[model samples]
Target: MESLLELKDVSIDFQSKRKSFNIIKNINLKIDRKMKYGIVGESGSGKSLTSLAVMNLLSDNLSIGQGEIILRTDEEKVLNHLSKKEMRNVRGEDIAMIFQEPMTALDPLYTIEYQIIEVLRYHRKMSKKEMREKAIAMLTSVGISRPEKIMNDYPHQLSGGMRQRVMIAMALVTEPKLLIADEPTTALDVTIQAQILDLMNDLTDEHGTSILMITHDLGVILETCDRVAVMYAGQVVEESTVKNVFDNPQHPYTQGLLKSIKTLGDRSEKLYSIPGNVPTPDEYQELGCRFATRCPFAFEKCFNEEPPAFQVGSDQTSKCWLHDEEANPNE
Candidate 1:
């Protein structure tokens, strides 16, 4: 498959008067055309930050320290190199993002029609009639029964699910090549979550848009993504197909996460959880594997050296010394 977006050795730096350091380092990911790629991890992992970097929407305190976020559509575009104005043009027309909370992302003062029309007004050259028609059609495509009525409603007037559908409609109205869905279903109920996920899959398929799905929910990744990247302590610990991740997890963190998922009809009152919180960016060591502090498989080498990504399978890569035969040779 042709590549859509590529993050090559991407590192994000957090700067302050007191200190400057990297929160996420040396991340490499290749998202293929029309491929649904997922980045899954707990809070403090660089899942959302990575997506933000791709969108050039990182805050004032943070900046891309190294590497490239290249978008390949009509031509090769180094997203980081583009100016603010250039990026504004690229955002809705080429790459759009569905944020975590539509409640917060959407403007409460503006009507749904006005907000949706604004995207088309800025990124597209359409008259009032065309914009209104397109916006309504988009809402309808996202499974809104009365898009015309919904269009006039305020974000607060609609339910969470409806607002999210509006967000999806706004995101897809321009027919962007890539959609960055940063935990889009987090704020909704279970039934609504499923509906939103299904709606996104169907709409993106119809529009031929690839998705970079960032979420802590492993089930969401399984449901929507073909490829998955397991992030821990601001780094990609494992990158593989969803099948390989479920069947044969390589990284210790990935293994631990899979074990953490609960199944139905459990007798024990106790729930499984990964021991220790993800180390804060300040606590991140200058040397050694970041997962070494919590990993059960950590050896002398894990604390003394940083492990490079080792090719564990034809399509899988793992960042752990245990996968390196030379690092811990068997007797």
Candidate 2:
């Protein structure tokens, strides 16, 4: 499969007056054309930051220290090196992102129609009438009822679900090649969350757009993605197909995550939880496995040396000393 986007050794750092530290480290990801890829991890695990880095929407304090974010389509371009103006051209036309909170993402001052129309105006050379017509059509396509009326209202006027649908419309209006959804279903009720996920799946399928679904919800990943990347402490600890992730998670962090998910018909008084919190960027280990601090199976080697990517299967790789045959020769 041809890759639509590739992140090679991508690292993001936050620079402060006192010191600087890396938030995302040596991340390598490949999203093939129309491949539904999911990045799952706990909050502050660089899930949203990774997506922001891809979109070049990181804050001014944050910078890409080393790496190339390559976008391959008609021609290959390194997105990280592109100038602000060039990146703007690539943003909506080639890549669009639906942020977590639609209320905050959408401008409160602008009407829904104006927001959607703005996208078309920037990406497509269309007249006012054409932009308005297309905006209405886009809203309708996202299953928004009374599209015309909704368009006239501001972001605050619509329900949470409706605002999210409008966000989806704005994102897909340009028919981008890649859609980065950073927790698109966050803050919605479970029923609404499912609806939003279904709508995204359907729209992306219709448009043949690949999705980089960034969320903490394993259920969402299982339901929506073809492939999964499990991130821990700003690094990809495991990468595999969705089925493999659910059925045979390898890395300790991945296994912990799976175990933490509650199953129906279980009557345990307490829910399963992973021990300890994700280390802050500054607290990340400099010379050892990052998860060693929390991993129950950690050994002296795990605490002293960083593990390389160990091929667990033909399609899966895990970064753990347990998977390193040299370290565990008998196993």
Candidate 3:
């Protein structure tokens, strides 16, 4: 299937007086039309940066060193080389994003009705009465009760879950083709989290919307994603179907992550964890393999030279020396 969105060798770099660093390195991913894709990694692994880059929302100080974020519509392909003004028009209308924090994303001064109506008016070219009706309907669809009353309430008046639903409603009010949800349920309780996830899944399925889900929760990815990308130190270590990733992860880091998840009847009085910390960008700048510092299987070759992406299967690849034919021919 043709991809709706594609990121080819994308990288983001940051510079400071202390040093310069590449936060994202040669990242490549693709999301097909109506596909739900997940990007998972620990904090500081550049998952958020990757999403921001795609949305053209990176801070002014950060620079995209290389690669292209290509958004494909049936009409045309848009490369990330467009001016800021052009990008702005595409952002919320064609592609919308739900931020990690709902309160921050919303205006405290405005009522939910005002905010949702604004997006509808700006993007849908609807009349005042029509936009107001649609906004209330959207809020109701997202599981907000007494939608008429909630619409008049400000952001601070609503609970966390309600605020999140309002955020989702606002994003959907634009009827965007692509939705980028960054930890959409992180702040909600387990029951509410499940409801939010279900709501997102149902709405996207109904709308045939493509989603780029950025999350650290493996459970969320397992439940929601068609495919998964695992990142470590700004680079994708392994990527494949969600089932393949759980059943047969290739990279050591991927394996470590899977092992780290707590399982039933596995109380050994100790938690299994990948030891050590992720190498800072500066610390790994001169090393061939960034994960070598924490990886137990690292060899001299791993420290001296970077490994190429090795094909593990039709839809899976891993960037590790162990997967390299020249390095491990017997396997």
Candidate 4:
């Protein structure tokens, strides 16, 4: 697959009192054309931050302190240095985003028709009738039964599933090369979630759009992704094919997470959960593994020295001492 978007050594930081503190450190990921790539981690683990940085949507108080977000179109376009006007042109045209919440993402003040057409308005020059017809066609394609009637309705007038479908319609209307879906199904019920996931997968193949699926639910990742990166405390601990990461997770964090997933056979038993919580900014330790404090496999090396990404397979790496050759060969 061709490289679509690449986040090289990307780091995001928070600025306060004329000083900057690292919030996301050394995060590297490559999303390929037509690939459904997932980033899975607990809330506040910086998964969302990394995706936001890719869209150049980071806030004033936050900045990319290092690395580049490159969009490999006909040639490499570094998104970090693009003017707001330039970035505006890129968004919805080259890369579109669907937020977790459809309610907030769709303005209450605007009708669904106004919003979907607005995307085309921003990216392309079209006659009023042309844009409206395209908007209706896109909505119908996303499975809205009454696309014409629903177009006149406000976001609040629709069901959650309908609103989300509208969001997808808006995102996919441009047939963007990349789609960044930040837990787009989180707010919906199980059936709706499955439908949305299926719709996205179908449309992605139809449009040949690569997707970035960000969610805390491992099940969601396993169900919808081809490749995945497991993140912990703002850093990717392991990255590989979804099958490899699911069946042969290398990082201690990744292992613990997979073990925590509830299975049908173990349904009657108490559900497993990783103990402790993701550390807050001030609580983050300066040395050693940031996850050491909560890690069940932590030892002196784990608490005293940071572990770098160790090559574990042809396409897999884990940031854990357990993968090191000398990490106690006896064990």
Point to the candidate with the largest lDDT: 1
In candidate 4, the residue pairs with backbone N, CA or C atoms under 3 Å apart (3 or more residues apart, or in different chains) clash, namely none
**Runs off by more than 4 Å, candidate 3:** 329-331
Per-residue alpha-carbon lDDT of candidate 4 for residues 28-108, written as tens digits (9 for 90 to 100): 899999999999999989998888998999999999999999999877899998999989988998999999899988999
Better of 1 and 3 by lDDT: 1
Model 2, residue 82: distance off in Å is 0.1
lDDT of 3 by residue, 1-331 (tens): 6788988998888887877878888998989899999999888788888888888888977888999888887555555797988887787787999999999999999888889888876677789999989988899899988999998899999999999999999888777889999999999999999999999999999889888999999999988999999999999999999999999999999999988899888868878889988877666655678888888888878888888788989989999999876776345
RMSD of 3: 1.4
Better of 3 and 4 by lDDT: 4
TM-score of each: 0.98, 0.98, 0.96, 0.97
- Which segments of candidate 4 are over 4 A away from where they belong? none
Residues 1-331 of candidate 2: C-alpha lDDT, one tens digit per residue: 6699999999999999999998898999999998999999999899999999989989999999999999998899999999999999999999999999999999999998888888888889999999999899889999988888998899998889999999999999999999999999888999999999999999999999999999999999998999999999999999999998899999989999999888999788898888899999999988889999999888889888889988999999999999876786447
Error of 1 at 265 (Å): 4.2
Which scores higher on lDDT, 2 or 4? 2
Once model 2 is optimally superposed onto the true structure by TM-score, how far is the C-alpha of residue 169 displaced, in angstroms? 0.1
What are the per-residue Cα lDDT tens digits for candidate 1 across 1-331?
5599999999999999999989989999999888899999999998999999999999999999999999999999999999999999999999999999999999999999999999999988889999999999899899999889998999999999998999999999999999999999998999999999999899888889999999999999999999999999999999999999999999989999998888787677777788899999989988899999898878888888899999999999999999777887541
